[model samples]
Target: MNIPMFTLLVGIPLVSSPVVYLFGRLTTRAQVLTRQGWIVRLLALLAVVATWFPFINLWLEFQARGRRMFFNIESIWLQLDGISFLLAAMVLTLGTLAILFSGRYMAGDFGEEKYYAMLLAMIGLMIGLGCANDLFNLWVWFEAMAVSSYLLVAFYREQPGSLEAGMKYVVQSAVGSALALLGIALVLAQTGTLDMDQIRLMVGTMDLNKAGLLAAGALFFIGFGVKVAMVPLHTWLPDAHSQAPSGISAMLSGVVIEAGLVAMLRALSTLTGFALSWGWLLLAFGALNMLYGNLLALQQSQVKRMLAFSSLSHIGYILMGLGIALVSGQPAGAQGAAFHLFTHMLMKGLAFLAVGAVMYALFHEQGIHRPLVAHDLNGISTRYPWVALSLSIALLALGGLPPLAGFMSKWQIFVAGFQSGNGWLMGFVVFAAVNSVISLAYYAPLVNRMYRRVTATSVKKGSASISWTMQLPLLLMALAVVVIGLFPSLMNWLTEPAGAALMSIFR
Candidate 1:
């Protein structure tokens, strides 16, 4: 028997979560500073690293055999294709880096073990979602990811607003999940199938109730839209992202929402008439998200809150590409969306980790954890040169500046939009372009502040230095952002096939 690569890919971390918790329970806070705590930290990190073997093997197998893989064991169906492979790679790469950074950044924090556990579980569930070939399995993974993330958001239970944010997140997510489940029920009732490929075939061939399909589409849009942070449904994001620990914030802003969009795309793919039913709506919402999110981000002085809003704007960029794909039936839009998803993970993940490093340094200096304001970063570059530099790179890339990962990704999306050749969609693309420039209004100023001189009152009296564990992820991600920008073709092998896989459902 093969090693069950897909199963192990998700199982490694999922199983490790409890083991880490058990080990964590054995160590006291003081013991955590000692060898005992290091044991727990290593356990968490090694579990994440261990998954790499299976992932690499799966990728190699995928390449050698063909473009796809499928598994059926114990009645669970798993599909591995370009889309799942791309998403799983993103989840594993970012999850590993975030957990590694946590080894240092989360050190000595209470329940440090639980933090690692939840993070791993969330990553595992996300990967499961990417690979799920059944509707119910996808929802299970989605809900499980949400539950684990909720706990993470409220991790600092004693913090003033952490619990409040968690409450809001859970409530909204529960509602969204309910709506999504209802959508699934409708589909299952009409077609008598939970398998995505079968559902696609049935919908295409059978004359199902048109009204039920329309209702399913609406339900799914609203359900997944909340996670995608589409304007009207995005109320929970800023609070949740701002309240979560910095590393978790990076995961949430970076890959979690991207996973939600994938779930939405998969569900929508099973139904017909997406171009007529949802394309225009997605375009309108995409425009709103870009403008509204950018405008809000511009007004934020708090660092994490600003980044939270920025994620929404970037989500808008991605949705516009996907929307164009649906409307025009072109693969370029989907390809661009897929490419941008990969780059956004790198750019935003770097940004949050870099910001987290600063906060970690600040905590050591001040003996307290507090929200970081942009103004506090003034003159920070003089002391924490590497962190300051990495943050700047992240900010510039996010603003879609040239020769950076963000630039290339955004360029692909814009080109996809233009290629639609529909005057109206072309106009929407132009609007997205203007919003991209508008985003820099905030991004540029933040980068500028990092280099400016600070007043004596604003400066910390003690030297603030970041640990190498945290610094390594920052540099690695920053390098990726720069390298990918300059050489976009390097990722084409993955992005092209992933795009084709996604568009295949349409055909």
Candidate 2:
């Protein structure tokens, strides 16, 4: 009954997705609608938890077997390393919570079964992309992730905005994939192998034709940029993240785009290998992404859409960490990037879920027509205290206020910036700091709606109560954010090892 753990890690959800879908479909015939939802939920939970074991098993093996990278499938193929394990931890943890949040958010939707299937499938694909050892396999996994995410974005097909956003996402994604494939073809032509290490070694050489190499590098960078939603390429995100279901918003902002960065990291490792020139280019874009995203976010009235732009700004922080990592070969920047990814995923996921809770209480169950804005959310702190508390914590954290999850990660990135020994790096750090303040410009209105000022009004009583199923997830994430901020050291193990291991590849 023993299965290759790697296969188990990837297979559990891929296999169980169908089972959950069919079970959900078959159970539709049952008279008890309530039981049907819980049944599907239980199955999805088990599947996610099963996939999560790879991280736990990896830690045990590292302790017992003392290996940095576990070649679960051996050297000729996909492997699991510290970085892969760390990212998998984020993907599965958030994936599970988002699904749980969906229980109430999607309670009576007709397409609930398909939602389960697609969400689970997306998580598995992301894990596969992170573990992939060769360029071709990484591309395959990336494509799968893209397709599933597009479907998930447009899951509420009845909404015209949802359909429009999904079309834009897929079309842009296809163009990105084509450029990625072209880059892969060029690498294969030059190196005669799809192996990442060989590609890196070949491209790293001085004798390779510089002209052809640069063109391939450009294609790969632009291609991955589309997924990472790097500013100019980021138009699809605000719509996709906002129009999709709130649960999907959490996933999209939380881990889906980070998956693109993960693939980009793999591509960069194999194709460019610490090319300082490319790192400088990333540095420039990091600054622009921060400025552009925050400014636009200031104009957003829709809650989810505002968070969507905020996500674009956070990507700037992650990229800044990475830019320093590549340009200066500072492991601190990479470590900070990993930390930001972990913290941002939790913070953003919680923020979306909290918003979802408000929407659930206000729109879904109560049928209020209040626009999704701060004005409408006035006196919310008194009404839905749980949602208000969680939402407020998420907002402060996103704003990089101290003593919260967001501040610690951003501080680390800034410290890493200072450590880079380049005065120019300070300019990037300052620009980021300025953008952080700019971000506060938008987050303030939301905060005001929650606690700052409220005029008593006779609104419907008992209208904003959220179910415990949704409340618990929001509270758990809020607690985690506080705990992590108070003791950032909790993540030092994973972040340090993941950063160090990946950087060692260059040395």
Candidate 3:
């Protein structure tokens, strides 16, 4: 797993799709494959594990070399550099845990093979998207990930809302893709090159007019904002997240949405070289996202849907940091954004996985259709203390409670906000601080509900036990959250380099 062979990070997952498909074919026969789904799960786990080593090595090289080019295509259409390397690491880590959690979370289900393959495909596609060095390369991986995710969202087609969720996700993504392609076309028309490096050169030297620049920026913003689920572009996220399997939900919220933000950042970082004036616009949108997303999340009764809206607000926090970076010319803002993205993944992943554990336990014992209402958590702590504790930790972290990972990340964003010392940015900083308080309003109640005592009539008892496999991922992530919270320097070590790399594109 040397830096030289780091392209294997993407390659391993690509090769895994078919190998998983082959083994999935065997799951139908008892003699050939265990009825317990050990084959497909193991192959998927191995593929996930395989994706991580290269990332760890690439990360080390990146820290030591500070922008080492690990691997690339024939002409470097997709290249592994500091920015892509860390994103690839996040995708693989969450992807591995999602698959492992699914092994137990989705056991004994029909069409398990196809389900597993789609998960692997998503992991591979997201990894490729992270490392893509050009806009067109990103578009390609995006279309692929959209296709797989559409299927993954509809994985439990027999269930009531799965098909609708898949359809909505596809329609929204297709619209975004159309707008994204237009943005790419605008760039290609002006620059005559899709390479980010060359785009930088062209933007600096060419006479690309203001109108053309603005149009391209708007199209890219609207397009990628759909996936980021910002306010006004956010309708699709609630249903898709609330309906999708929890393991898949983790990917969608944890890394898949961030992929959109990263792609937009890549394009903007290059376009900003042309003196693009998107700073004020970014601040406006970021503030709106924080205010709107948190307000709506406060009203949700469904557990997953609440998490979904909160995700919209979390993205807002990251956007605010990024906006501050672009507007203020301070790299620490970018560092704060990157730090939030990284830590947010762990928190959301744990939340989704733990919630999924509850869903899985209830799905087996309930006689009929089971919806994921907050009421389902009534006195859950009395029954499943570990699940309740893990879920509570994640909720607290995301709510920006002190002595948790989310607090440190949010603190960085706040620092970045005011560092500019501009009147408008300072106003938004205070506004975001208030919005953070609004966010805690919802998370606190849910944690309290989970720990409260329940009357027998109010709480439905689950007959099946949640296995160690399901609980382990949640506990591990919770522990990681605590460790990082205690040692906040981990944020600086990982994200400062990434932030520096992002800023270097313009400098």
Candidate 4:
């Protein structure tokens, strides 16, 4: 049967999630294929590959048609907008990489069936959230993603910290979802429509006597703020990221928060009159995140928690770009945000995967009791040289060094701020650059530990053979960071259509 590209992106992962569980169970029950675990691995691999087809089709379609404001494939079950298309493509790409990485990461772990199932389910919900055009539909998918993530965060149910982190995540997300629902209700009461495009048009014709728009905007911002883990609302992030599986942590830090930002941007697009106030709010939060996240990261002894806090700070940079887009009304700001989102995905994913490799080597020797100090990872460069190299590249990219994807994105955002003539925004961007330098203080120590420090007696023997499943994702993401940095036109072409789409919403 034929399906639209949008439907396939959403459906394939949603459908395969259950199938993975069933097939995994079947294999276990029969006891005939225990030795051939590769079969189940291949099946999971195929599911991820299937999801990529739609993005390929999307690229082809964009090439055939000029970068228009919108190109949609609408049906009873699925709807696609240009903005949704770009975000969905990002979700799919990251989802595929995460799943591929997990195949190796989870190889020896029990409950592989459930792990793969939840992974696919989260991917499906991410696609749903990205492509949803109506407020209610967006909320539904948002909750779906949240539920899956909560379960995934606590996937190691035996670990008390994991369970506690998951509980905290769910409770905070529930509160955020309730606020979003209230905001949606207020908007629907005023405009009698849930469609984003319709709401944007309706806002222009409505009276602003009661400040209902502002109230709704505040609610929406608070709701999505929690999702993106903006300051004050971000209590659950460090705990969850530190406790969860590394692949899931990568997914959470890399793509899930980006999806939340996309939702907030969509909501903000509906209330153009409040753009200045919202822009200031975004700017304030972004600045706070950059300052707070990095400084807190410096204090953390645990490697994963440090990275989690760093992720929070980088979210601030992206939000700054969004704020510029709103205040300056420039496509360049939006384009920069998109480029940053893409590069952050690769950089963060590789970083988490590197941590996973370290954990895999040390889990038996040290158990979870041994703290992961910079010194603990000493001699990893000698043992797993490729992994060490990949991790170094990822860290340098995260630090926004030249000839890397992160640098390209950061440069564009700073240029866009300058072009917009927003002195305050430009100053904030400069502050972010300073924060990036501060971040290097923490990140550089880890590299030094890996490459330069002498191995201690506590260090364990590293794995002799790195699995293809794990290595493939890191390699691909590392290469992507370099490729996109060298040739930025590829991302610019993809993001132009999306920028046009948001611009049309205002028009």
Q: What is the lDDT for 9 in model 4? A: 68
Off-target runs (Cα >4 Å) in candidate 1 are 29-35, 455-458
Writing each residue's lDDT as its tens digit, candidate 3 over 11-49 gives: 788788888877777776544756747878888898889
Candidate order (lDDT)? 1, 2, 3, 4
Task: List, residue by residue over 336-381, the lDDT tens digit for candidate 4.
Answer: 8777888898899889888777776666323443335667678788
Clashing pairs in 2: none
Q: Show where candidate 2 strays beyond 4 Å.
A: 29-35, 63-67, 70-76, 367-371, 455-464
Cα misplacement distance, residue 221 of candidate 2 (Å): 1.0
Winner by lDDT: 1
lDDT of 1 by residue, 342-380 (tens): 999999999998988888887635677688898878888
Evaluated at residue 172, the lDDT of candidate 2 is 95
Report lDDT per candidate.
0.88, 0.84, 0.82, 0.81
Q: Largest TM-score belongs to which candidate?
A: 1
Q: How many clashes show up in model 1?
A: 0
Assess every candidate by TM-score.
0.97, 0.95, 0.95, 0.94
Question: What C-alpha lDDT, on a 0 to 100 scale, does residue 102 get in candidate 1?
Answer: 85
Q: What is the C-alpha RMSD of each candidate to the true structure, in Å?
A: 1.7, 2.2, 2.0, 2.2
